[model samples]
Target: MALSRDRMIEFLKRHDYDPNTLQSMETKEIQEAYQEVTKKLLGSYFHLTNDNKSIKTNSILLDMGELTEFKQKLKDCANDVITLIECLQEGYMKFDYSEVNDLLAIALKDMPMHKMQKISHIAYRSFQEILLSQIATALKGLPKEEFKVLEEFYEKRRNDTQFLHQTIDKLKDPATRQQILTMARVKLMVVKDFMPSNLYDVYRDYYNNVPQKLELVAKVRALTGLYSKEYLKEMPFEELETLYQDILKHNEQEEQDRKMFLKYSQAIQESVDNNDDEGFNEICYKAVTHLTQKQLSMLVEYMNGQNPFFLSKFESVVHEYKKKLHIKR
Candidate 1:
């Protein structure tokens, strides 16, 4: 039995594939192109991560926040299709929808596993937008001087709009859009690796200062049996000597823990710089135990740049770590 053009397009769209991409390929090549693009898209979906959290489920279940963002990205992705059609109608591309559809049907036969990969790249793009937004928010908390440095960094590259917007107004060719996206990802990865150091400095100060405030509260609570500052003036100090001593002991231990963490972080950086694999591994083991998703991303970027093969090693380590920690989607 021969497949109808309309039926083939329906199957592709139902499985979240971009049917319009067929227009870009020759009549005899649509099947090969569809198969290749679908495989690549599925692979991307399998590796999808948000803040170091792996998404391993076969289906996407988004929260309200994610749903809203996904809708916007889907809209943006759809605009590309509309723009392509408009350009083609305006004589930019010498093809129409009917011709492409007819060719795609003849090329694409019945294929199973289409429903299993229902999530489209457009949805994944939205997820990426959320991840990027989180990264930007993390970077925004840098100290004023460091933030100024980032601002200057952006200012330096402000005029380079070659890959800034993915809209059709700038990129008329679908192939060029794909090529630019590939290059942009590499630059984004490098930026992800470098920008976190400034944020880490600010976070380190926060981690150090918070314990001081906690210590002060502990001291006040010990002496006056009061946890609020408003009651400090009215407290009768009978010198609760034992209580004061206990508070001091606890604060000392807390300070020691902070110092240990600082030492470990320093060791990781030194290990990377000096090419000390064992030392880096030791510190990374300790650091990964407490690292947030943002920190893990930065570390991956750092390691990947140090050695081309390190990205796979780091990913394997993280996979094991996630399993050990029982971190699920």
Candidate 2:
């Protein structure tokens, strides 16, 4: 029941590790690596609790004695993992198992190993997202004194930015400039709560409008550049303002698209209930047009339990979209 070294190496590399280093490692070292990656992948959703203590999801270390045990656990515990993700995504972070009993039952049905692998990958990704969102929620719920501490740190970050602007002129070495830019990028965490009111408003808009959490760190990282200080000096405020306007326009369009999607989703549901193929096709076509790629992926996964007729319709719609958009799916 030994692990397939090839498969393990593939998994590690997919998560951005250097497979060469792993190749030379002994059994214990490989196990440690597996545990570390597993905790990282699961850390977000498993550790959430309604407590003052900081969340720690890393403690769920895998203890499979051999590959047989490992594969068995992956198969057996798959549904529970999916159920936990579903509940957390729905904002039920601390609910009892009874609440998800039916969902677990449905998820436990037989499936191909490859399909299970896909679900496992999705569950890991979804957990990471849920964890980030939970961390933001925790920050917002902090006590008044802790909240003030965040504000003070944010002020210090602003002062640091000014200092960097002055120092950038003196930093002639490329390496030093790069180091300073990295520090500045790390400091960008301050933006998460820098203007408390604005952050709250942004989160509110995200929840009310989008189906998923906005990846603020990623978005801000794009705004923060390599040699970030120099980039700011080179880019004119007029251009920056235009970029902001474009973001607003994109968000507005997304909202409109979601509205269209909802209308068609409801219409499709009614068509299914009434056994109306023509109505279903008409509504589903409209729905597919409004769906983002991410939404389409989720919809395909969700159709597993539905009737084959409906599932085929959705698959056809997704396939056409992928061809048109040149998506790799």
Question: How many steric clashes between backbone atoms does each model show?
Answer: 0, 0
Per-residue lDDT tens digits of candidate 2, residues 65-152?
Answer: 4423433433466657565445433322222223233233344456555664455446444644444433334345343333334333
Which residue pairs collide, candidate 1? none
lDDT for each candidate structure: 0.44, 0.47
Q: Write the per-residue lDDT of candidate 1 for residues 120-168, one digit (tens) a residue.
A: 2232234334333433343454444333443333333323221122222
Model 2, runs deviating above 4 Å = 1-235, 287-309, 315-329
List pairs with backbone clashes in candidate 2: none
- Top candidate on TM-score is 2
The number of residue pairs in model 2 that clash at the backbone is: 0
Top-lDDT structure, candidate number:
2
